[model samples]
Target: MNTPADRATRVQDIVTVFLLSITAVLTAWCGFESSKWGGEMSIAFSQASSARVQAAAAAGEARDARQFDLQIYTQWVVATADEREQLAAYVEDRFPERLKVAFDAWVDGGMAEDSPLVVDAYVAPGDAEAADLTARADGKFQEALENNQRGDNYSLLTVMFALVLFLGAMSQRDITRWVSRTLLGLGVVVALVGIGLLTTFPIKI
Candidate 1:
């Protein structure tokens, strides 16, 4: 034998409890996803840093190898210009394998290029490997940034859910029925919007 007002109050209480429960679960899920994405971001950043260091080392090796090749090639040029055939031969014989291949190609091409350094075949020892590692580092860095953004999105959603929870709690307080209903309505709207946004975000285990 409940009056209409009593029945309405009971309905409000039920709606508030439902909203609070659902909002709490969603907030927890958002927090968990944010943490997972943060961990993924950290791992990606670490991998990126490791790759960068290895790339730098490899690039340094390539630079040093190229410098050595340049010095040997200069010696060969000077000996050849002075018509010192034996000295030129000695320098040529000691050319690094990469340089020797390019030198041979240059000679076969009637010495058309200014130097074997310009030849396509003259790749420094670690040049290709360094380039590959650098690309890998760049890719990992970009991935880390994307992961960080995803974590931020989840954090924002967690805040949104928290707001919904607040609204739901306020709705359950002793206030005017209309005001209570308004707060509950707002909480429901916010929760729906949050769920929509959450669906758009990627999930990370």
Candidate 2:
């Protein structure tokens, strides 16, 4: 019922549709992957930033607490037993009291990502406010320290999750399998390095 030329044209149209379908599918798949990767990257960045801020806060607070303890101890050294007891009681009340207030301040400030302002708030130099800042620094330092410590863990987990997500993104067949495997391995290595850096880097008190 059909001429040879008509049959040939029909076949060509079918082939064209097939090719276009393949391309569309591939594009859609890649777009999905890209979106996922973007999300993971964003989450990782946020967590890393938060962790850094917390670490700084914790370290600053711990140092301040130590210094406060030292000052209190110094004061206790020259005082009478009754005076020392009074001072001890005062310190017990004051340090904990200030700690509560400073902690509330830190949290109310939104536990934001690390910035120069946050660091400056905790560790300013050559200022006569060291005495006043001691409590604040101690509180922030402790918060930051705890965060850094947890950051190591969080970073490691995120790296692992990224590796998995990347692998999923590369669901194409006929490519070298080694490429994906190699990327996974490299991700692990990168995660280890991040952990090492966090562990080895000494924070300023």
lDDT by candidate, in order shown: 0.93, 0.47
Stretches of candidate 1 above 4 Å error?
none
How large is the C-alpha RMSD of every model relative to the true structure? 1.2, 18.2
TM-scores for all candidates: the values are 0.95, 0.33
**Candidate 2 segments whose C-alpha is farther than 4 A from its true place:** 1-12, 73-205
Give residue 130's error in model 1 in angstroms.
Answer: 0.9
Question: Compared with the true structure, what per-residue lDDT tens digits does model 2 show for residues 7-66?
Answer: 854664454344334434433443444445444545555655655555566657667664
What is the per-residue lDDT of model 1 for residues 1-205, given as tens digits with 9 covering 90 to 100? 9999999989888888988998899999999999999999999999999999999999999999989999999999999999999999999999999999999999998899999988898899778989999999999999999999999999999999999999998888889889989999999999999999999999987
Task: State, as a TM-score between 0 and 1, how close model 1 is to the true structure.
Answer: 0.95
Model 2: worst 10 consecutive residues (lDDT sum): 113-122
User: In model 1, where is the ten-residue run with the lowest total lDDT?
Assistant: 117-126
Question: What does the lDDT read for residue 170 in candidate 2?
Answer: 47
